[model samples]
Target: MQNQSLTIKKEKILTGDRATGQLHLGHFVGSLQQRTALQHQYEQTILVADLQGLTDNGHNPHKVSSNILNVVADYLAVGIDPQKTTICLQSAIPALSELTMYYSNLVSVARLQRNPTVKNEIAGKSFGSSIPTGFLTYPISQAADITAFKATLIPVGDDQLPMIEQTNEIVRKLNYIAQDDILVECRPLLSKVSRLPSSDGKSKMSKSMGNCILLDSSERDISKAVKSMYTDPSHLRVEDPGKVEGNVVFTYLDAFHPDAAYVHELKARYQQGGLGDGTTKKILEECLQEILKPIRERRKTFISDKSQLIEILRSGSQKSQEESNQVLNSVKNAFGLNFFQL
Candidate 1:
């Protein structure tokens, strides 16, 4: 119903979650925060990628389905305006899947296997010789997702740079073969903060690992998680000098705390041997609570009105469908796949 224009002068961004679970603090620090700031500056389209989630979650349809609204609520809670950012469900846009099928031919199996992001993920899942076909091909689907919206910017973690490179490769291949600029290329908008380590000091914060602080976590939950967060393992005494690097609590503070000067002072005190782990943890907890309280309250409001949340997603998907149809039609015409075209 909105002005879902197929042509716009402003640059566009397309990004979203996999609808695998509730978003966490890591997501906020890494991408969501950046997205909120960029929405007004760019024509943004945020997607709840249910079909891509199925690459790994195919057997768990209910998990993906249920988490779609949960992800939408998290987006709204973090200030992703439905009026400014088109938040849509991936499965609802049929054009993306069709684009993926065509784009798949533009890339080769060896190239897909060589993608660093894919290799690391497959290694983590330990799929061994039986990696699902969909899991292997999800990057092509991602390429389709970006090109379908003509998105020129993608907010991604450092590890995902290869995915964008792969997308552009397909774009070049398509245009060269068609002898027309039928597909647009996209670049990665890298996150400013490096990956946030898990509270338990793992290199990554993951839902499957059960080490994340959910965006909607209660104050009590936040406190409990922060108290148990990993610190200098060898700092056996309160007066002992502690290492600040790789200290998960300090890392979180650096990522989320608003007062840079204060955090810097805390880090210096922490390394100078007077700051106790409990004291630093308390500061980190307070800072996190201050940031998350508003988000939690906002999430509660959206979650209570499921129909409204669904309607927002439905409307966004309709607008996205209209826009994607334009790109899909162009692709079909370029490839001579549009049998109806004279």
Candidate 2:
């Protein structure tokens, strides 16, 4: 028999992004940076969630397909070591789809509708009364993604807590019905930086909104984005005292600037009316450029070799499939659905 003690010591983490666009600074501050830090400590599996992207981009399948490689490049560029982290494509793992199908039966339409994350997203997209079934049921698919790997830790933003709660609910229901511990519940590792707003000072950074500074953004792009960042609207002159509250530039600095004392001083100066928006923006631009320069250089090297990128994803998908298949078989066996136990 396998050593149960050894199994208990292993910590597995599952996290990823929707393959709709290149990741941005918001992603770095929100989860990507955290993933890189935790990769060595846990058995990390990062999914390029093309299937989930299809939930909303079903009509534009090309958009999702085209961005898959770009997303992978961003991951590699941001120091997510392919050697240390298993980066897999979600659609490539058939087990996840199969698991989602079975898990869907365990959840209710009313329960899915009640999920706060889903509701807020649907409303934000203006789907109103006509919500896509796939979009609404993505929480179940996400649950499948988590339980298939038996991941113990899921790194997510605070807004995604409802999805984690819903996944645990399904796990509990399945275990109770099958009278077996076939699936494991996951815990959310909430991001230290909640969410980064867009350069335009919107609530969230969105690619479609054209307000994001991509992980692979050129120095010029970063400068342009920084220059346009929202600051105190009423502070029109250099000598006028500016409001720091709701200023997006200050928010980015607080999240990324390494020098806390310098940032504090800048904030004080801006509040007291000596600092100008241009000078403040220049500081922000320099800070962002310093952070992104290395990542952009690294991304160029990976993007130049498409075949190598493909191989890395293919290898990771194969490994992920093997791991998820074991859990799927156990689940099938628990429910008396394993007809041919190979």
Candidate 3:
């Protein structure tokens, strides 16, 4: 399969994570998997969004700084080949912030307030009316992030569809006012997986939730987590006949396991009675281990060569700056704001 050749048109893609914490299986299946697959087919930039991290983590620069390497480790763990993809630190590109400042003026507080993505995020985080200024305007920053590299495709989960729309709106607004399409629009590349459920059967798998399985978890840790994972509460006995609806085990299998026929058989047995939750959980552990073992091993190697990893970031940032400068220059010229002597 690795040697089989498939041909298609390719477009530049920019996608990344906020370096808020170590990424988990949710992140890997949702975005990293697709990014790794597309790196060879497209011009790609996988950014560690440290500057974007400042939006909510302003008081925790150390938190963001420490996680920068952790997130980079996650990227490598998931097989995002740095040789095929430019891995950049977003804060290292000054022009992105510069462009964000100008783009901020083009958007009004009312317009920003109307952004569905920002609205949902603000409410989800319970910021209500007092949302942080930076967090409120993050979509604009995202637009800057995308436009800075002229990224044409952005891989995001379903909930983030509004973000791509917001970015295209910005692109249209900027081009209309500047009378040139200096900012390229971005389209969403939605994943085939559903939103990964939390181990505790919670609504989301967040770092604070204590429900995530980290990429670096040991085999023993994986076993413990799987054993404790949420399944049908009514499934008290092995013969009770369980329900798979809202079962984290089944949800995970649907997302990660490739053996669809085996999974279907397992689900049928569980629903028809006799199959134990423990048995299902053990199967999940085995399936997850197969996928994560190589990733964890790769992460260990990346962690060992910390300085070399940092050098990779620096080189990638330098390349990013070159591209950002060209885009910024084009944007400035479109707005007639590039005259140095004016």
Candidate 4:
């Protein structure tokens, strides 16, 4: 078992995924991969963001609950050792809710509205007029989640940098006004590779879009998903000049394939009118299958016994509560809001 107290030189880290659905390749290369690496170096807190899940899936709490296990399975399957990381379900932690209420007052509606990430998300989801209050205030909730753990480093993709900035701004504002350094400032650990797009190459891979290749998917399913991936539309004939630019096949190769020189050679040949899109897609499919094999096998082993999986989460939630309580007490003292007069 890995040690619980990793040498986190700065402060702890709070990072998690909303339990919307099973995590896919996009999540793997973008965030989860980096998170697993960080666990060895930091006091990592992984939150199953059920409360944030409700922002959009409020009517489907059961779906969210079911997927919570799926998300955990994905995490475990990807090498996130439970013994080294504290994993907590967000709704299970009451201190997060308490912190969110306090932080919300520190931020204004206008500020959230101006957040580029929020704006893009709202537009993407077509929440033009009926955006829920919870969804709108999620940034503040995120601040609570981060501060509750006193996380100094949040690993996220480049697109999520705005949220980190928003959290930091709130941290600075609260500490400045209270004349105390209560909330720790957080920095974004951006991934070198951006998120993978959907199989059709139209947008980012998402559960709702039905374009994800899940970590738990069978080898056949992964092959099928990759086989159907979109490529250059103009490349009709095998010998026709193919464009590697914007081709999903080349994109995946660029992101995942270990042989950078080979991929660059393929791209050069692809642009020169000799390489076939089908051949390129085949290579990508094979490469993806190789990468996903171990993850799929691990997931199968995990699903073979539900009891152990449940125990992992229960234990994780308990451990997380212990740490979060300490932070909450410090926060209460900083604001002179301790209820018991201790």
Question: Which candidate has the highest TM-score of all?
Answer: 1
- TM-score: the better of candidates 1 and 2: 1
Question: When superposed on Cα atoms, how far off is each prediction in RMSD?
Answer: 3.0, 2.5, 3.2, 2.8
The clash count of every prediction, one per candidate, is 0, 0, 0, 0
Backbone clashes (count) for model 2: 0
Worst 10 residues of 1 by lDDT: 1-10
Tell me the lDDT of candidate 1. 0.92
- The list of candidate 1 runs beyond 4 A from truth reads 1-8
**Model 4 — which ten-residue stretch has the worst lDDT?**
2-11
Better of 1 and 4 by lDDT: 1
lDDT of 2: 0.92
lDDT (CA) for every model shown?
Answer: 0.92, 0.92, 0.88, 0.86
Over the stretch 107-209, how does candidate 3's per-residue lDDT look in tens digits? 8899888878778777778865666799988988999999999999999888888888888888888899788777888898998873787888877777646
Sort by TM-score, best first: what order? Answer: 1, 2, 3, 4
lDDT tens per residue, model 2, 140-228: 99999999999989999999999999999999988997898888899999998878999878669977666788998998899888988
